[model samples]
Target: MFEDGQVVPRAVLDSLLCDAAISRYIFGPDSQLINIGRTERIYPDELRRAIIARDTHCQYPGCTAPPRLCEAHHTKHWGRDHGTTDATTGVLLCWHHHIHVHTHDIDITWKTHPTETSTEKHGKRSRKNAPTGHWEFTDRNGNLIQ
Candidate 1:
């Protein structure tokens, strides 16, 4: 049921569950209603910030939309794949690309790089390396996007 109390189909509910705030309902004995908790964000602030820092911009190929204009997208969907809501499984995508990805069923594969310590002699920073992780996009047909 919606806030307007209009009953909808399960498909509508499933779609909302995929990328919406969720409220965990607690129960009591005798199946009595107990508590209705506040809705929780799909991606928490810290994890979202980490993903934004790592991505820096939209991960959809040449798109350069900054983190401010992007949203955290789950490479492995939480509802579909039971994916974890962590930096390792998230990426930054602009609104257009984010919607495009989900609409067209684009696949995202995340590859992680090990943390490398600087080998500099003094306290100077070393040359910057790749990000902690990266993602590759593929179409539904399994063809990689350039």
Candidate 2:
């Protein structure tokens, strides 16, 4: 699903639905949870296209990875009960960096800074927020990269 660059087919979706139904029938209603609302609107095709165009690659600084290996990350996680799902609260990140951003207490700041030419540069930067139990990424030369 990640490599083919194709939308999920209906047959596979049907099979998944059947499996879930069988599980629910055997285990009981509490075994399955259903989401019936506008949550799916957040992952529309246009949003994916916008993510690709805006970020171009992984938004993690110094990472040259492409979009195919990355995911559109929501800065504010979406929940069934929570109401916010705006475009500004999203970023693109590769799998490793995405997990790192969520699992650790990392501070991510999205702002505009002045460039050498005195022009504004807008982007996101990560800083370690925890005193301990924090994750770090380093380059091959044993220097910290993130």
Candidate 3:
């Protein structure tokens, strides 16, 4: 199907559906429209805003796209995997990266802050500052992406 005069591929549709307000259309065996209604948003406005604030840029590794160019993506697919639409399960990604992930079957997971220990000259243990959180990206073949 076409949207905004552009051809939308299945991968793009899958990416969009990750964080879109969906509507359901049911059809009958005779090709008659049986029911139509809007469904709950995958990523509501407030949750999406929170994710944007948290990420502030594309979450795809090495990507620098700003939040304005990003879209909220589910770490797990909502349709295929019955993933929950929660802030903890979502990340911001640019349009290109979003489609790339779906097309390439990339998996994303969040890692909490980890303490890094260092030994001082006197053999005392010290903690080093580290990122509050990090994300891991892997391909369908189980290869990690930097």
Candidate 4:
């Protein structure tokens, strides 16, 4: 159902529907990304809750802002690039990291391990290579942060 770089994961959508967090939405003829109208929030309330549950701290390598304080950032840049607003497409980042990412020279990539090595035992999504609560942040010159 997805390639490595695709947005709007089927697993996250299934989870949302199965949990009754959000129902079906009707899109208009306009081709613009649908905004659910939560004032300025890009991610939905339920989606945000799901993210907080998975990411207890900032997903950025060394930051430790608690889930609630961290902002749910679209890895693909939601509004500007029409990034999807699902679990696989989103990550929590502290204000500092968030600002730095938006304004600095860094690349945040979701790195998933092979399914055989996945520690998650829940039978639902197979997650095998899902977000896994870790992300790879690299500099413009391709140096991974340690």
Candidate 5:
């Protein structure tokens, strides 16, 4: 699932999906999140793996919640900001911190690749978010969250 590593077994990826570790996320060369059709709040499989790979644990900085328990959270609320279901717009947050993030107005910023070109067709429902590369956290005041 990574750009510079050995291929993850499809079985592992399937298991992660069953465990709900995959959420809205990234993808590899054969496919990209920018090319998937998104349903209202449901993540396509590729997106899910991308998120699981991006965050091996709850992405709340100090939280150690396992990936299987995390749900995809939009750094920008989907309804409120028209957030896309892509890694650049998503973060993995466990149940507790997920609630906290929303209530506290924390901000998650992802590093992205705006110039990367892809041959896949962009989904009509997909937001035009740049593909996420890496990420950082911040608070409402723009100070680092951790």
Candidate 6:
């Protein structure tokens, strides 16, 4: 049951109960309950915003997609430690590129280059390349160009 202002669709509520029943069958009677007393919150909104501002767009090299289409990915997995969840340790990437970054064992290099002159403004960092030889840009037929 929910408060007056809170609403849940009947279909969604039914699906949740169905899922709980399946989980109980697989993991025993206690599986449907959550033990949250020791859980820690990671990726607070401040950190998320910082990550968005720093990356500005997808971190995959040559990917022109903007941050609005991207997700914040921790360089180190969140399950490993809290340090990995910091905004400075994360990168923004679009869904397709995010999968490539995590699942393909691709190597990505991030670096900062200095500005030529102070009046020229501070130089921003960038991703140098994608580990695979495929170019980010391709022809209509999807052939990579040298």
- What's the TM-score of each model vs. the native? 0.63, 0.47, 0.67, 0.58, 0.59, 0.46
Candidate 4 lands at a TM-score of 0.58
Model 1's alpha-carbon lDDT is 0.71
Worst 10 residues of 1 by lDDT: 32-41
Candidate 5 Cα outliers beyond 4 Å, as residue runs: 1-39, 111-134
Best by lDDT: 3
> What's the lDDT for residue 39 in model 2?
38
The Cα RMSD of model 1 versus the native structure comes to 9.4
Specify the highest-TM-score model's number: 3
Instruction: Tell me the tens digit of each residue's lDDT in model 3 across 67-120.
Output: 889887878687667666667778999989988999998999998886676667
Please give the lDDT score at residue 85 for candidate 2.
32
**22-44: candidate 6 lDDT, tens digit per residue:** 11111225442221111322344
RMSD of each: 9.4, 15.4, 11.1, 14.1, 16.3, 15.5
Q: What is the full ranking by lDDT, best candidate first? A: 3, 1, 5, 4, 2, 6
lDDT of 4 by residue, 1-146 (tens): 34776786543443332222222332346632333432233566666776787787898777888976777776765444445556666678876677666665466778876544445456654534543436888887899986
Model 5: which ten-residue window has the lowest total lDDT? 14-23
Cα lDDT for residue 89, model 2? 49
Alpha-carbon lDDT, every model: 0.71, 0.49, 0.75, 0.61, 0.64, 0.47
Model 2, 44-121: lDDT tens digits are 445556667767888776786898998766554443223233334456778777766555524343455433322334
Task: Please count the clashing residue pairs in each candidate, in the order shown.
Answer: 0, 0, 0, 0, 3, 0
Superposed Cα RMSD, model 4: 14.1
lDDT of 1 by residue, 74-145 (tens): 776666665555566678999888877877788899867877666665777786554575688999899999
**lDDT (Cα, 0-100) at 145 in candidate 3:** 97
Off by over 4 Å in 3: 1-13, 19-39, 117-131
Q: Where does candidate 4 stray beyond 4 Å?
A: 1-41, 115-133
